[model samples]
Target: MQKLPLTLLLATVATTSAQAEGWYGSAKLNSARQNLSSALLTSPRVNERVDAPDNTKTFTPAFAVGYAFMEGWRLEGEYTMPSSSTFKSYWAPFNANVNSLDTHSQRLMLNGYKDIPLNDWLSFYGMAGVGLARIDSDGYQTNETRRFAGNRRHNFAYSVGLGLDAKVSEKVTLGVGYRYVSMGDVETGYNTFANRITARDEQLKGKLKEQNLFLEARVAF
Candidate 1:
């Protein structure tokens, strides 16, 4: 009778371990650099599309929970925290120079990952995700005389990444990765004052893209 109880206990432990191996939660910190495509400024008085200035960089965080449904394959839902960057650019003819324009973004994604075991303690992974991004910007002065308004929009976003993972322990893994993200387009609101005075109610539109380097940690539960 005692042996039977011991056998049941062993079976329960094995089952629990097996179940825990498939579920994991992770957190990551990313150093992301923003790349903006050419921006178009449209208004009744001026309609011009010109190249944007330079890249902006920020630090962001992400979190995910996943289940390994099959060997070497996993699916996860992740949330990227909001981050912001600022840019300054000059527009010719209109003499509209942006003193400071700030942009912000946040995203929610569903990702699938394929892992290949390189050794007993090392693995390589590639991942792709699709999601929605919320993009917004803050109003700023142009040429210290005219001020532009800000707007918010939601757009479809996607990302792809590849990385190497190190198994630190039975339940923990650490990784470093690079990802490319496309966040669709962002737009700014028209300045009402400009509209009334110079009939220059203009809005700026630009595509937002990013390259990110990240460090991540995952724990299996």
Candidate 2:
């Protein structure tokens, strides 16, 4: 019957409107690995390019405030705290390895998520975000000699992830997820050796990427 179809449609709309709808805040801890593309180090004296190694893993923290506007959609703004990792690079020209070199990053993002209910207390979700990141380095050193000054740069960043969320209470949810993020590029300052300036103090440049596994908790209002 035509009237029966209309009644079912109205019921469906009502059901959707009654689903999760409110503002929420979340906190997350991420086990992150920083992957640096092979960097090129340039200098006038060297007369050739040199390559550097990538970075290691570290833990970082992130926080977000979001609004669940519809049954399965939400938007949030997230901020990731700065985390650092140490790496060593061998400079053939100097004939030594740079020690205690550290790099770190901080990010701010606007993210959107879509969720699908799997059961009464569980849901699966996917998310994507676009943002800005600031990457910094503490320069390079070999033994007691400083070869370059540190530098910082701001770049465009983006991420994508998937996860499962469990509702423990009407107001609390917990989740675990994995995401891949691109933090853009970074560069080091001009070269300096033994407290003296070089004739052509070229810089080192590289691209930065990250893979993160995160655990999070959210509370709705």
Output the number of the lDDT-best candidate.
2
Model 2, position 181, has a per-residue lDDT of 95
**What value of lDDT does candidate 2 attain over all alpha carbons?**
0.79
Writing each residue's lDDT as its tens digit, candidate 2 over 1-221 gives 79999887876654454357999999999999987775656555453334466568988999999999777899999999998866555556664545344678899999999988766677889999999999887566565366566889899999999999988888999999999999997777765664335353566667788999999999998
Which residue pairs clash in candidate 2?
none
> How do all models score by TM-score?
0.83, 0.83
Residue runs of model 1 more than 4 Å from their true location after superposition:
1-21, 44-51, 143-145, 195-197
Q: After superposition on all CA atoms, what RMSD does each candidate show versus the true structure?
A: 7.1, 4.4
Candidate 1 lDDT, tens digit per residue, 75-178? Answer: 99999999887766656555555534568999999999888766556778899999999999754546544566778989999999999988887899899999
lDDT of each: 0.78, 0.79
Off by over 4 Å in 2: 1-19, 44-52, 91-95, 99-101, 194-197
Worst 10 contiguous positions by lDDT, candidate 1: 12-21
